[model samples]
Target: MTVDRRGVLLAGTGGAFGLYSWAAGAAAPAPKRLKLRRRHGVRPKNILVVLTDDHRYDAMGFMKAQSFGDTPTLDRLAREGVHFRNAFVTTALCSPSRASIFTGLYAHQHRVVDNNHPIPPGLIYYPEYLRAAGYETALIGKWHMGVETDTPQPGFDRWVSFKGQGDYLPGPNGLNVDGAKVPQRGYITDELTDYALDWIGKRSGKRPWMLHLAHKAVHSEFIPAERHKGRYTNQTFRYPDSMRPKVPGRPMWVENQRNSWHGVGYPYHGTLDVGDYYKRYMETLLAVDEGLARIMDLLARRGELDDTLILYMGDNGFMFGEHGLIDKRAAYEESMRVPMLMRCPSLFGPGEVSQVVANIDVAPTMLAAAGLVAPDGLAGADMLPLARGEEAPWRTELIYEYYWERNFPQTPTVHALREDRYKYVHFHGIWDVDELYDLATDPNENNNLLARPGHEELAERMSAKLFRLLEETGGMQIPLSADAGERNELRDPKGPAQAPFPPRFFRPPGT
Candidate 1:
């Protein structure tokens, strides 16, 4: 089936590329007129994008993935604007995902597949287009693209950022404030918000502004603010069912990882409990929630709350004891899907958008809101029409890729095809069995159906489609850069036993 620009379903050729062309084709064109025009006249809209690290999709009060997750501010954004319930990232890592958001290209396309890689030269960030269109741009908080420096990059008028995965508290070397090193005054979350609000309030001209307030909270070694510390210490956690030991049909490598660094039995060197770690992560997220409230309040007080386009999203989703894993860089739902909410009453009203949107779509959406078109060859479409409840042709499947890192070798390279109701994950350079899950029936991915009696053709078709996406999008070659960060492949001496090889690997007596 092929969908046209008007979203009309039509009969099409039946081939590998015929049925799935629209999903992996070039981005759809923008509407003839955007929603940036106001009642008074045509004017560009202000944009504010707030990003958090390792936030899960259902970790909000409304979604209730956690029993004690409180996010009144984020809930308000979903209540007042468009909630992208099915948002995901192509690569579930900090630098690669952030690079995708800025450049509107896949990690392989932009050549920033790993955290230590730098943004390839001559690549223009979409914010530069917004700046060229007479809008001021500012970047505050974490910019983990090029792990070497915190100095300002192009496309932003004002810059306030820190080094890679900056310290939760003030460190020996403080923040880099527009080419100067300054002492971090308070908690990283609140201090980043202070810089963001200061920049937003100090603009003196009539030009619309774009601010990217990225927070470093909620990352590993989680540390909550003074007021929010131990907030969820007493709350109970609802662990995932897939975390059970010796789950039937579970991949052997996933079971073996239970004793590795990212596994549940020995998470963070066996010194961390999954429940306590999860509580701390949620607690650390509280300050980010409060910061959102403050930004919204300031915009409301200035009478621009409804007019300004505000977006709240996460760089990548974190896992909590899912499939015996604790971090991202895997193809599981909890590791790739993130919370994405956008509010601009001038563009759209309160509702939910069910389409599968990715981090690569953010750049085009922001450019569309500012009445500017994104550059050619972007891998994402303008999602404003979908947010406005308009019928538009969209992708039916998303390709997720994660390159193997020398720092964390427990998880292998992953390339998966995620459809609405099914997923097929392929592992590279490993001897483990691949995974296939019927998400509609088994959302937890407890039962892998790769060896099922009647699902062989389904898995074969999906696997073929997965590789075609990579071959078509120039992702066939893996990009390698200088390896950095500490190697964390160490396993606890007395942890759980390594998973044995699958029984299928052994031959029958007759054979």
Candidate 2:
């Protein structure tokens, strides 16, 4: 497992599906709507994406977190486009990273790995292959992968959302739209951008659309939008490097999460004040950066804003006090790195890419920005030709997972891999001692160089390249979803109201 393969695997696409052409097999099956096979874009462009919930990866303002709390439209979208600077989310919660960004697989091949885990009847939802290729797909807000029904599934033709982790408070559990629940009154990120500009003022723009929005902003009970409540209360938060308490080798399941329940030494049981929880998750990300400047002024007033591709991200990454943990299922690096960006100034220009993208490469880079095709095993990587600088065959090693939830049960069932500046991790049902982290001289992983004595052959060659990338991305099962029985813990807002919520994850004994 020295990580090298010629002709990067295809055919029944389990691994490097970055090689497309339906990864040598499965294709014909998306048309639950538009039915397209011809207009492979020399024209049909449009695609918005956004997605926020628990938005981390240094809560924007261009990776300068602390008092630099502001994201003028995601810092002018990272100074106008492309900042992939190592994005991630192989499964760092929130409906298995939004079902690995709408099914490019892996949450153990889309069994919807936990969080009301349902959708497993032979998955598929890269906007149903862009509404069967003629685009015009639309899934507006937080559709927490079939949990308590927002009811309007199968690949969009306009379907705003709600139910499960929604409610940035447009009047408690409202807006369902395409299936009509509607009630949405005030601020749930400005009424999902005023019902996405009233569905782009009733579009008849003929094809090319993909919307997706998905916000439920800055998760956790951190509701900001009272004009960003007490705005960053005179800042001051920084504290990361495994929030101290003797580091140099910290990993006894991160010292058994200091008394559990997502413990930053007693978090859920109270006391989380990382200076008022990073000032209400950076003031609930300034109304998701003013609803991305009102959807970039509604895509520059529908002139399609320099030929639409836009993106933004984060269905994962969020852990304030770091390994003392705050939220997000931890494989750590602040719970699976996130914040990605992308734009489309007539195809691709801006800067900062760094590679390592994830959340299964946003549904084959939104089915290759609407030109469609990525189907087969779809594990993900059409990062639009690595965000259009071209040259394919990317991914050097990245695999992360997190499965211990019966309501956080003190973090376990892990597996990590990062490669190039190392990372390793591996814990699964915990017996301890296996961590590596030389993120090139401890990039804030606080130096747990695994049994360091000259790093025992780099931790046995990254534990055989983390089980050969968990058998080339199928993640070798164990993602556990044999009807995870008594479910309902969508970060617990009394969804399944088990009355007084105690550990309750059940369903574990051989399912």
Candidate 3:
């Protein structure tokens, strides 16, 4: 409630505009300590957050999105816990989404808009707050943010991570263990799980601990563990209806991207069949699932299964050929939506939650689980109460943003507003047309109703809401950083070409 009104809140946004006490000066520092509170009848529990990269929302066995997709560990977690059915990320890239999860701020607010951007100086991670509250924390896996350094970050007693996207198999760059270089012994997923279990086993003290086990599986160059390599080879791949070459009202940019590196037609700029790639991706995810099973088994053996808060989520969703696109960074469902499952029988019952949740909600939820209130200026709300079936005000609309990256120039800067039944996407720094989807009826997003008659008012209203949300959250200004990552301009010679000039740009003399 102590807000320094830096600017007047925009009218009708149902939000405020101000800075927290921590945002007072240049190089504003993250609060080194958090105030802890005691809750009635709810004891602080061990928290284990299992995060996977590029794992989409519906890829679990329960959803059956892919006939071959089966995640027994993930499915059991959902069955035993609360499944946030409509969880999404504000930004669909890895680093930005991870940063949002850690800071409880939007990518624009945290200023890690793209994968290459480093964690802004002085931005506090959520774990730091937990650490301050007397919780032992360890981050054991990929820390791709803060620019490529595997060095130990603050706020954790135990630190085990790799430089950017550590390989599935041990490559040149090995593991970084508490600021020391340790050779990656075996498969990355299994090894990370080993580190996590080892840490948990050694915790014979009274203080509750929190561990963030981030996995490198199911990412690009999808490599499955030796045992899971050919697990789904016999299953048939079901292509999404929207993956067809043409869809009415589809943006030209999406069409032109079909032959580029992240497209269905020529994925990876070669003859990589998306079907096979998807199979491999599913195979790669099996190891992560097994790792989760191991974690749960350990907790159960220690009589802490029901006492621990176990959460499994994907950093961001992936696209296996939706809208002629093969990767994320788009406002499409498969790209922005991610799986979020949380379990702690001592705290809440198991059921499906329809309320929309996102990466930003993670921090406040964790802090709430620890019986502490999140500091002001965090854009996310605590979902633990909501999950307990408490009647709290929930967001009716969600805002999504993805800044254009120089390395991947195919997808433009995207801004979108997602409501229960409708989604409106706006493109920036490009000449492409905007998009609107009626998700309830057109789940595939095969149609863009933005240009349709009688839908103009709806589009305008959603667009207004989108911009107002962005403005209210201090996302009106685009964050630009020095260009990093290798740029790829290659296109398939025989792939589909770009479309002609749009009519909005120029009109024939009489037409």
Local accuracy of candidate 2 as per-residue lDDT tens digits, 278-373: 788788878878877887887798687878888888888887777666787877777788898888888888887787888888877777667755
lDDT string for model 3 (1-511, tens) is 2112111122222222122222335343433445545556666788999999998999889998866787898989888899999999999998999988988888877767777766545567878878888899999998888778889987799999999989999888899999889898999999999999999989985999999999998788999999988988888998887888767678888888898888877787788888888899999998899888998999999999998999889988889888888879899999999999999999999988999899999988888888776787778888887778888899999899998888888898899999999999999987777898999998889888854456888889998988888877778876555677888767988888776544445657988
Give the range of the ten consecutive residues with the poorest summed lDDT in model 1: 30-39
Clashes of 2: 1
- lDDT (Cα atoms) of all candidates against the true structure: 0.84, 0.71, 0.83
Cα deviation of 54, candidate 1, in Å: 0.5
Most accurate candidate by TM-score: 3
Per-residue lDDT of 217-291 in model 1, one digit per residue for the tens?
789999999898888888999888878888867777888888888999898786688888888988898999999
TM-score of 3: 0.93
- lDDT score for candidate 1 against the true structure: 0.84
Cα displacement (angstroms), candidate 2, residue 421, comes to 22
Go through the candidates in order and give the C-alpha RMSD of each one to the true structure. Answer: 7.6, 20.6, 4.4
TM-score of each: 0.91, 0.34, 0.93
Q: Point out where model 3 deviates above 4 Å.
A: 1-33, 36-41, 501-507
